[model samples]
Target: MPAVNRRLVTDYDLQDAMERQIGIRVFEHDHIVHSGGAILRFDDRTVVIQAGVSDLSYFNRADCEFFELKKR
Candidate 1:
């Protein structure tokens, strides 16, 4: 885990914010909630997760993971 961007999204809008982003990382220990999609990882920067699949966390709820936009 790294320093997450507090300004990324509020607790009330986490899901929506992640949906909008082209690439976002949703970490899960058991089953991969979201997958089979394209993701972009910059040089020591952010990861973009393209949507259009099952919302893993939503279906089988879990602890919310932190994230950042990753400024270069």
Candidate 2:
């Protein structure tokens, strides 16, 4: 049987990553992907990310296969 319920990150982890100003890589498709300085915000269907120093990028949550947030 396959797992039904899976969580990528908790609320606390999100907050901590933001506070620490860490980097994250969001994997969308097998060949299409993007990464950035850190995650600004995320919702049920989308994520707002910081691409450059003062620029933000938006990605669809449904498109992501996985995401990685830096430890520190």
Candidate 3:
């Protein structure tokens, strides 16, 4: 069988932040959490989630895996 894809309002916020130049906090899988400044860039296939000062991680959005924005 093939896979299905979907996007949520939160996902839109993520893309919007990337486009509008707004920094946001991200809660990812494996109990990983990143701050607003941690987001580096976004592309068609993945989002660059950073950690510490220079450590960055790539996350694929197609998995339909959900993440939350930390409360301001």
Among all candidates shown, the one with the greatest TM-score: 2
- Encode model 2's per-residue lDDT on 1-72: one tens digit a residue: 442322246556556666676666667667537665677887777777786878887877677643454333
At residue 65, candidate 2 shows an lDDT of 42
Candidate 3 has which clashing residue pairs, if any?
none
Error of 3 at 13 (Å): 1.4
Q: Tens digit of lDDT per residue, candidate 1, span 1-72? A: 453433223443444455545334454564334532334322222334544564222321234343434434
Task: Say which candidate scores most in lDDT.
Answer: 2
lDDT of 3 by residue, 1-72 (tens): 553322223556666655654444444464444444534676566777655577776767553243434324
Give the Cα error of residue 4 in candidate 1, in Å.
7.6
Ranking the candidates on TM-score from highest down gives: 2, 3, 1
Q: By lDDT, highest first, what's the ranking?
A: 2, 3, 1
What C-alpha lDDT do the candidate models reach, one value each?
A: 0.39, 0.63, 0.51
**Reference-based TM-score of each model:** 0.29, 0.61, 0.46
Root mean square deviation (Cα) for candidate 3: 9.4
User: Between prediction 2 and prediction 3, which has the larger lDDT?
Assistant: 2
Distance (Å) between predicted and true CA of 45, model 3?
A: 0.7
Q: Higher TM-score: candidate 2 or 3?
A: 2
